[model samples]
Target chain A: MLWEMSASHIEESQDVTSQDLDEKLDLLSLQCLFLMNQVISMKVDIERRMKEGTGMLAKARYVMGGSSVSTLQIPSEEAGMTASTLSSFEESERMIGKSLRLKYYNFRVFPSAKVKDDTEDEVKDGIEQKLSNLQLDPRQSQASNPLRWFGVLVPNSLREAQKIFGGVLLLCAECSSIESELEAVIREIDILNQVKSNRQQK
Target chain B: MSDFPSSARPGKLLAIIGDEDTCVGFLLGGIGQLDKHRKSNFFVVDKSLYPSATNIEEIENAFQQFVKRDDVDIILINQHVAEVIRNVIDRHTSPIPAVLEIPSKDYPYDPSKDSILRRAKGMYTAEDFR
Candidate 1:
């Protein structure tokens, strides 16, 4: 009679555990759905922007061929063109849940010319290297014009292409963060699946 | 001493491995960079310019090289070009230096073939929720 009572209690606890796992799995799947939608929309946006940017680029190439832009062309090696990234990713973790989330941040444009000066200042302040101590003057930041690398007198088509692609680059950055989140949700679902299967087997 | 904000620079690069037009468009955006090693973060896989010149190995190599680079935080490849090296792209498991397969001038975006989307769909069906 005692064995029967203990068996009924164990069965009741098993049912509750499996029900909890099911609820968790459903929540994760819903998260996956949301993330999947976000990614697909971003992909569509990327496609449209890329098509427009490339079309403008092709037009620029054609215009260059018809004109004397060749004389103004800077050799790849000589241009020495380098751009400071305007975006970055920050990683944070939920220690209890054991899940990772990547956050994307877009920074203001800092011209390459100013980068050297900033490095020097940073070196001087090495004693107090805390990021909070550094006071960033907004007016000090300048608009980034990469077309200056080609020449001050670049074709209109080229300028338009640059503007279009710049937006696309930011979109790409945002998409990466969303995609990473989707990966995390999928991982959670997989773990729950293993737990559910293990329970069933036992 | 200018009271400039502590370096807003993220110091990370976005690498591209795409066709001619894709490379040109993005390069014009000011993401183009050439390091002291004379190595560029972006690689152009153009077969139209030099017909049949770009091979699978070259594409794979560029993708692998970009993945190995520590400074690159994001790698963007054209969807059509990514098809040539789908296996390599799928094999990459790192969440950092995220790999994003984007559309190109000639090809449109297809979500079904997207590596991440496919994995999500494969994991669970709508009926499973029911």
Candidate 2:
């Protein structure tokens, strides 16, 4: 009876040890999931913030560079943004900075990789000559804007759609021409089939 | 990666505007596309080329064309090359393809010249009271 009790105690200890191991495993897995979630969220957050900056800059430029404001006169709220819109935008601007810091935090010292050898003047002169040839001037801001004067031309989407529409129209025209050719070939085949049938009947 | 086709992914293509070494490194990573016209997804900026003027113009045009293309997802430009066309880079507004500045062989990346980072700093100075 004493031997049996000792055996039972040993079995009980083994069970407790296995249960402990299982619980530890579960906790480790949970921690792994949490870290993965954080990293994924950070990546998504960075992308969203970058996109936000691009969109806001474009919108701000459009409003500030409105055609009606030919002079440096104060732009009307109706031309671009209202007082409320500007204030809310001010709030989003803060979030934008925080997110960018997150992206730069790790690679902040990345530029240290560059080796300095060339004189600054030589580099600047080369770039200036290149810019002139490309008709791009660092002095002129609007020259680089791909969508410059777009605010005056058409709503951005309409312009994009017009380009897409032209492409689709070309595709449809090609398809119609091909279809006509196919119809002619099919008519010729039908007549040939009828002639074969007439000869078979004879 | 198994769930979706690669083409369906937003910003599926990465465009680069950098020096020969930078372009070659990216091309080795499988981002290079060459056409019959000898045009590619990247432009190699070589200061040693005979006509330095034409090289810069070509780089500027390549950068502009890449920005205008629909297939490109992200534009990675060397800080040195970006300096040459900083005005054009600053003027670009579309959010679909984000333009990012990277260091080159000769020049260190400047935080002050970073448009996005500069905008982010501007927000920190806003009036706030707790």
Candidate 3:
């Protein structure tokens, strides 16, 4: 009778240990998910702002072009040519400003790790090896090129869409790193939980 | 206007010592608008308001008042103006407000001619090994 009681107590202990481990894993997963969501939201905000800026630039250009049509009165042909050249120069300056702003957005969109072209492939390989060595289930890796993804997802406005998508791609890379770290901690807890369960069974 | 906490807010005074057009552009940008009846971003002290004929003394007084204020974050002076008040500007060691030399509208920015970069290069060369 006493032997049977001891065996039942051991079985109950094993169940409790496993439950605790599962709860801890769930908490870590939730924390990682929250961080990922924050990054995604920021990326979305940046995309919206970029779109608004582009719209403003387009409107400004249209207005400038329209205004010139009404003021075509010139005393001499040379004067008209000079006026046209000046307007063209002003238009070019505006275009250059827009281009510089776009470049800044592009620079901010990528993750620090993927900034260097030479090391991206090697870094990806390293991440895969680390996961496999730890015997952890690897999540699906996102495609290397953000432009390709933009082409398929947002086909109509390729230039603007690609810039926005690039921002999200960077956020995704950050999320992946955070997830990997959390995975390691959860795996260790799982291993400890398994050991406790085995001991209780005995 | 947003009310930033006193401690967090930038200094209340800004002095821009530059040519006429440069000062005008900054004024339009809302640098200093202190009125007894209204709120302002900064206390602008330009060449027109305080002429250079009085020598560096008048300019120094304005600089002193601006730098003494606890609320200012940035002090922008044109490169030419800075040349005249180089001594006074150099004497300022406080880190609360950074003093920046901006190019006037008519003048072009020359990286090679910047005083800060020149000083940095001098220090670097002095420490260089054979």
Top DockQ hit: 1
Give the backbone clash total of model 2: 1
What tier of docking accuracy does candidate 3 attain? incorrect
- Candidate 1 stretches greater than 4 Å from native: A1-16, A66-75, A93-145, B1-9, B49-54, B125-130
**CAPRI category for model 1:** acceptable
* Ordering by DockQ: 1, 2, 3
Candidate 1 lDDT, A38-99, residue by residue in tens: 89988898898788887776687687664332213323652455654444555533322223
What is the lDDT for B52 in model 1? 44
DockQ of 2: 0.02
True-vs-predicted CA distance for residue A88, candidate 3, Å: 39
Clashes of 1: 2
lDDT of 3 by residue, A5-82 (tens): 334333443545556645653453454345345434443443443344334323433544433211121112221111
Q: Candidates sorted by TM-score, descending order?
A: 1, 2, 3
Which candidate leads in TM-score?
A: 1
Candidate with maximal lDDT: 1
Of candidates 2 and 1, the better by TM-score: 1
Which structure is stronger by lDDT: 1 or 3? Answer: 1
Q: What is candidate 3's CA lDDT for residue A98?
A: 16
Report lDDT (Cα) of residue B120, candidate 3: 28
